[model samples]
Target: MASVREIKRHIKSVSNIKKITKTMQMVAGAKMQKTLSALLASRPYAQLAWNLLLNLAPKTERELHPLLQIRGIRNSLLVVITSDRGLCGAFNMNVIGEALRQIKDKETHFLITVGKKGRDFFIRRGYKVIAEFTGLGAPAPFISITPISQIIIDEFIKGNVDEVKLVYSDYVSNVIQRPTTIQLLPFQQEQPEEPFLAQFIYEPSPSEVIENLLVRIIEYKIYAAILESQASEFSARMMAMKNATENAENLIQSLILSYNKARQEGITKELTELSTTKAVIESLKK
Candidate 1:
């Protein structure tokens, strides 16, 4: 049992902690809302781009485009997206875990880490990190992520890596986030439901248009993934801070109860001692 003084000190400490956690929670919530808006706005564009690719896949020859050219998976490049700072529960770990699972059996796999957490995790364990980009800021701009997409595109075109994959946390809702793995290179072709009956003329040339569109699609895909990851990170941090604040409140309440109980016991003991002294003095006087 702690004394009243000790319990009071504990209460004060927990109250201060609660204040900090509450502030953090509010901050995270604001960031999450902003990131979520960006994420939602980008999602439709990403889907449309992908659908256009699917429609174009049947028209283009695999030999004409380097991005559509499929090769043996002898070597791979993984782009892992994580948060620069932690304090979020399992957000970074989940992404790292998914990336590890992806490359568990691969013989040659290089990493392009997008955050400090993933970069440090792989580097400390002797993993090959070919490139690293950190502190890209929350709700990362499309322009900032272009270099990362360009790197993978250049690698694929140069035959340096056969396959390119991305590992990120997808934002589902405020309370739910899911780690996701997606292939970015050697675009997969899916047949559309209806066959092409109408023919359309290319603006300048089919090859040049397809080439540029492929590059833009890759860049947009990477940007969308980063946005999803940013939203998820903010959501996770907000929830974690909320939980911490609640726990601190509960702890402070318990400490206050203990402090009151101890103070009451001390007062009872003092009164008992005073009563005893009065009885002895009265008897002595008689």
Candidate 2:
């Protein structure tokens, strides 16, 4: 049994920890709301672009565009996005695991990583980390992704790399984030499953339009992945903090129960001692 002093000290420490976790939960929840809004707003645009590409790219000389052309997946670049700071449970690890599993046996692999966690993990493992960027915001800016996307695009055009794939977490809900991987560059749509594919018309030349569209499409894909990862980060953090807060509350309740039992035991001990002394005094007087 712990002394009351020791127990009190533990309770105080737990209380402080509870405060910190609760504060973090609130902050994460706030950030999650904003991220969710940003991601949701962008979804329509992304979907529309995907649909447009489906409708347009098949009819034109989309093969001329490097981004749209399918190539052998020989020397590939994997872009892995993870959180800079982690208290978000398995969020970062999930992405890292998926990415590592993907490129572990490849003869030659180039990695472009976003976030401190991804860069640190692969670099330590002796992986070839070509470029890394950290300190990206929760809802990362398009400008932040522009350079990263351009580098991959240029590398592909130069035939330095064949295919590029992205690994991140998909934000399903506050309580659920799933590890997701999507191919970025060298995209070949599996033919749109819609009747509207036949009713498409291209302005100017098909080649020119597809050439312009291909760049935008690649940029859009990169942007979408970043947005998804941002939302997932916040969602994971919020969920983790909420769980911590709940666990803290449960512990506090258990501790309070123990504290009450201890106080009752202490009071009972003193009462028993007092009664024994009073009976002895009465017997002496008699």
Candidate 3:
């Protein structure tokens, strides 16, 4: 058995830890609500852009658009999105793990990493990280993300990379986030499920309009994915912090129980010794 003072010290430390975790949980929860809103707002725009691509792609030959032309695999570029700071449970781990699994044993792999976590992980492993940008805001702005998208587009157009893929965590719900890798370039789309006749006049020409739309679509898609990742990060952090707080509370309770037990035992022993001493003194007095 430990001394009562030591037990009390442990209890106090655990209590302080519990307070910190609880505060982090509240912060995460508040951030999650805002990120969720941004994620929801982006979905409709992303969907509409996708639908437009599906409709426009069928009208033109794939070779006319560089982004739509499928080429044989020579080398590939991967864009990975992760959180800047952790305490988000397995969010960053899941994303980094899936990316590594997909790119394992590849001949040539180039990495464009967003977030400190992913960049640091890849660099430390001596992987080829062509570009790294950290501190991307939650629900990243289109203007900021456009440069990242443009770099990949330029690389593909310049015949530097055959394919470009994005790795991110998809926000399914508050309880579930899934790590996923999606091909971002050389896009091929199925015909629109709903039969809506194309009835539009292009300003310059159909090909030119389609080309411009494809660029915007690519940027929007990247932006949307980043938003999804941010939302997932927040949700994961909230859940992780909540669990931490709960576990800390449980630990504090256990420590308090131990401390009380130790204190009681000490008090009982002192009372027993005092009783014995009193009996001896009373006998001596008699």
Descending-TM-score candidate ranking: 1, 3, 2
Over the stretch 1-286, how does candidate 1's per-residue lDDT look in tens digits? Answer: 8988888888988899999989999998999898888878887887777666666666678898999899898889999999999889899999999999998654599999999999999999888889999988877888898889888999999999999999999999989999999998888677776666667677686777788889998898888889889989989999999999999999988888889999999999999999999999999999
Worst 10 residues of 3 by lDDT: 50-59
- For model 1, the superposed segments whose C-alpha errors exceed 4 Å read 51-55, 105-107, 193-198
**Which stretches of candidate 2 lie above 4 Å from their native place?**
47-63, 104-106, 190-209, 277-286
lDDT accuracy of residue 265 in candidate 1 = 98
State the lDDT of candidate 2 residue by residue for 100-210, as single tens digits.
Answer: 888955457899999899999999988889899998787776677778878988999888889888898887777788888888878766687786825655678767776
TM-score for all models, in order of appearance: 0.93, 0.86, 0.93
Clashes of 1: 0
The residue pairs that clash in candidate 1, if any, are none
RMSD of 2: 2.9
Which 10 consecutive positions of candidate 1 have the poorest summed lDDT? 50-59
Model 1 quality (TM-score)? 0.93
Q: Residue 8 of candidate 3: its Cα lDDT?
A: 82
Q: Specify the highest-lDDT model's number.
A: 1
Per-residue lDDT value at 200 in model 3: 73
